[model samples]
Target: MNELRSWPGLEGDAIELRLDNIELFGSMMEIYFRHAARLVYNSDEGVLTLERKSFVNGLTEKRQCRLPRLRSLHVFLDTSSIELFVNDGEETFTARFFPHLDDRTILFGTHGHLHMDIEKWEL
Candidate 1:
């Protein structure tokens, strides 16, 4: 079981990643997007796997990737496409998927005892 931790100082318009009571059980992170915006994550691993589901019609897309010592990740979203950037723009992974704009909640976790700091904003 994973729980959300406590984090303060969010700008009140963006969502901050909370890790006070949350724990991860896998080597992957999960996030839900509700609107058209960008999502980013940073880690030391040279590889990553992404899993996402659309809020409308409950569709899903999955992929596995090998990045270049991923120190950061950036996801740019449009109405029908998603562009993923890794390592401060060192690499890019792009795909197309449909997710509900109204269901903007995102969930993130890791596969092991991985720790991270997460933040989000509405666009």
Candidate 2:
């Protein structure tokens, strides 16, 4: 069995994580944005989504899943692609997108508090 390793983070804190193999466990709400493309994953409703809000052609992608209370997720972002993994690779979402170079923002919000361990990295 794989041991669950976690780093400490408080609720409503935008913590910086420095690993290609990033881990997110516990109940969470993540809004990850790679430039123009944004990915939103919510555990309460069991949904993962991606959308582009820019001058380029508008597009959206979504994957629905009923995962565990303490779920695992991995995300990869490149110049033209974004990959998302959920629940120890049980569910995955991947797409190619043109990113807006000027702004890249990621937001995380929970039902009441951010009851999850998350670390962000600049890739």
Candidate 3:
């Protein structure tokens, strides 16, 4: 198993990830944006979830896709929105978000070791 945690947090409007072979038992990945939102990928369940915690009700959205086979992922952030793509464009998910947290810190975690490459961009 392997995990990565952001200590100083990430600052940017766009994020990208490249991962390979995610289909392992108990395998999962998550990205936390301070108290604003979170994106979770559950390889075992073939699910991708986005939760807006800054909302009054903590709104949650989910997408079911074969993530284990996906080798790439991307996230684009706007003033109040998020866009996600998987497998270099095989699938996409988009949503609007309102974050309660003012901090722009970010965190990432994985249940198993992944061949991952990450990048952040300022928009």
Candidate 4:
């Protein structure tokens, strides 16, 4: 099943999460805003994608990196970039983003129920 967890109006430069029973396939996670997504993790393809949409609705092509299957994730966000570390830095993905919206949201989806623990902090 698909699951989405949204955190709006969060002012932070870093985010961390621990997921229990997260399979490498049939799962996806997104960290985004109204205008852009900082990151999208697709387990099935072992890809971590980053994208941005312009103010006029122009969207950038996704940039991808291969990553190992993970149950734990850590993210660092700056004014114009994001850094992702998986499974205690066994793998990593990094990218740049420019978001037009001030509100930020986190969306996590899985084929089945999985327990997740998340935390956010301002840099």
Candidate 5:
């Protein structure tokens, strides 16, 4: 059962989620996306970024997601887009970009010491 309620994630150090059953989403049939994501924290700038991999016309998305709540960052990645949600959807960012087939990895980058637990999921 690949139900969302049954989706698996982490609670410490880091968090990861992969939507293996995209088929459940009726409108996601033609969508080319993934579930796993990267989590990066820049304590210096108080930003949380969803890193993009090397690909054609690639782009990365960042938000002024402050600290204290920095430890709970969530990033959802698809082959061509990214979605960010934090504090249970309090702060959200919807990012779209172009990606190549080889662009399958998400980068977790930061400038200062900050702990993050990012959950990755795709629809």
Candidate 6:
């Protein structure tokens, strides 16, 4: 079980994280983004969770989910929807309602410490 480390913060067109030479676990990666960012996981079987607090109505939304072997992923906020994609264009996970307070940050890690080379890109 290796210790988890966080990458630097990015703000621009888009930020991408790439991990190579590492094994992936179901739920072993966390990402924090500043100013609402998207997350994409390309691995065998993985899990994702979102944590945020509301200010307008004092509401809180936290979600955790599992994904099958995927080829790609995308997330973004328009007006009132969170969109997700998987398998290079096979499946997608979309949800309604906004639950992001501020552009805090993004973190990535694994529950069992999967080895990987991660890269964050601004797109």
Which candidate should be chosen as best, given lDDT against the real structure?
A: 3
Clashes of 1: 12
TM-score of 3: 0.70
lDDT of every predicted structure (CA atoms): 0.46, 0.51, 0.64, 0.60, 0.39, 0.47
The most accurate candidate by TM-score is 3
Model 3, runs deviating above 4 Å: 1-4, 7-9, 13-26, 53-56
lDDT tens per residue, model 2, 9-104: 311222233223323443444454544565555555656666665345554544455554435556676656667676667777676766555434
TM-score list, all predictions: 0.50, 0.57, 0.70, 0.62, 0.44, 0.47
TM-score of 1: 0.50
Q: Candidate 6: where are CA atoms >4 Å away? A: 1-4, 9-22, 25-27, 35-47, 62-66, 75-83, 93-104, 117-120
* Model 5: per-residue Cα lDDT over 1-123, one tens digit each: 112211133221222443221111121111123333344444445554554344544444334455433423344555555665555566776665554555454332222222323345334
**TM-score for candidate 4:** 0.62
Q: What is the lDDT of residue 106 in candidate 6?
A: 48
Ranked by TM-score, the better of candidates 1 and 4 is: 4
Q: Which of the two, 4 or 6, has more lDDT?
A: 4
Give the per-residue lDDT of model 4 (tens digit) for 1-123: 565655453554444443444444456666553345656667768777777654456657566667755577777766566677777777776666665445455555555445556666666
Give the TM-score (vs. native) of candidate 2: 0.57
Q: In candidate 3, residue 38 scores what lDDT?
A: 77
Ranking by TM-score: 3, 4, 2, 1, 6, 5
Clash pairs, candidate 3, are none
